[model samples]
Target: MNKKQSGIIVTLVVLIVIAGYLATKVNGPLYVNDSDFNEKTAISLKEGKSSSTFFTEATLSRDQDNAKTLQNIKALIDDANTPKEQKATAADEYLAVATATQNESDIELALKAQGFDAALCSIVDDKVEIFVKSSKKELSKEELRGIQDVVMSKTKLEKIDVKIKE
Candidate 1:
């Protein structure tokens, strides 16, 4: 093949590979990986720093997802083809999402106040799930109880699950 033709083929192959890698990355789960969380937590602990210091990217992704969800719900509420009852339901769902997002922030702040580095809360379909980043990488029974107490008190919901990550 001519040098120019060979160069074109190589460029095309490189582009294909790059596209495939990006596709997988975009499609993967949005949550922070265990290794990343652990590494950040270790460094923070070593430096006597809070987990929030390293939380920017994960928190931004979570906020973006939350915004997208709210936007989608708002679109449903505003759609002309939607029935009145459905629109009303969508409005309620939107409120729920907004409240949940606020509650997540409240929980994160509360955890931080109590000395945690980072925390995330998600409320869905009557269930609340919390993820906390602790220096120890795991929660003691007392810590779990305390978290459950805080979440239940804030959300007024009986169902809660809390996970601690490094």
Candidate 2:
């Protein structure tokens, strides 16, 4: 790996160690809103679904999408007709998505360990999108920061957007 890649891996390892330390030292369940979510997932917010149920449903949808992508990647890899460069690109994408999936799982586990009722983390490019079920509609600055820190520690992303999963 190149210097930049090695540096990022080192930073991620340190952040993960820190996240494990921080995860044991927080409390509270709350949420905020992102305008982007309001625009995108407006339908899912209706009908007063239970927070845990909503999280389950949304996670299923996301997993389904990821599975489809993985299947396509597998097809590309298996097909002798496909170009090597295309297969290589698909393989890279597969690894990145798999890593992001693990990172999301870790972040959610950490948030729940921090006392969140339900936490859903999605990493898109360099941005992290978090959907959390809150006991209160508003989160204090400290609470918000705690959530962001957990996510940032698990992922290389610094741009985090949190939304209410009510």
Instruction: Please report, in order, the local distance difference test score of every candidate based on alpha carbons.
Output: 0.77, 0.81
Looking at model 1, report the run of 10 residues with the lowest lDDT sum.
40-49
lDDT of 2 at 99: 90
lDDT per residue (tens digit) for residues 1-166 in model 2? 9999999999999999988767755642222223434546544534478888889877886776676677777878879999999989989998998898889889999999988889988888999999888978888898899998898778868899998765
Count of steric clashes across candidates, in order: 1, 0
Report clash pairs, candidate 1.
Answer: 51-117
Which candidate leads the pack in TM-score?
2
Question: Model 1, 1-166: lDDT tens per residue?
Answer: 9999999999999999999889889897544344554444443223244456536555675777688788888878878999999999989989988998898889888887877777877777789888788768667888887888788878988898887666
94 in model 1: Cα distance from truth in Å?
A: 0.6
List of clashing residue pairs for candidate 2 = none
For model 1, state the Cα shift of residue 144 in Å: 2.0
In candidate 2, position 154 carries an lDDT of 84
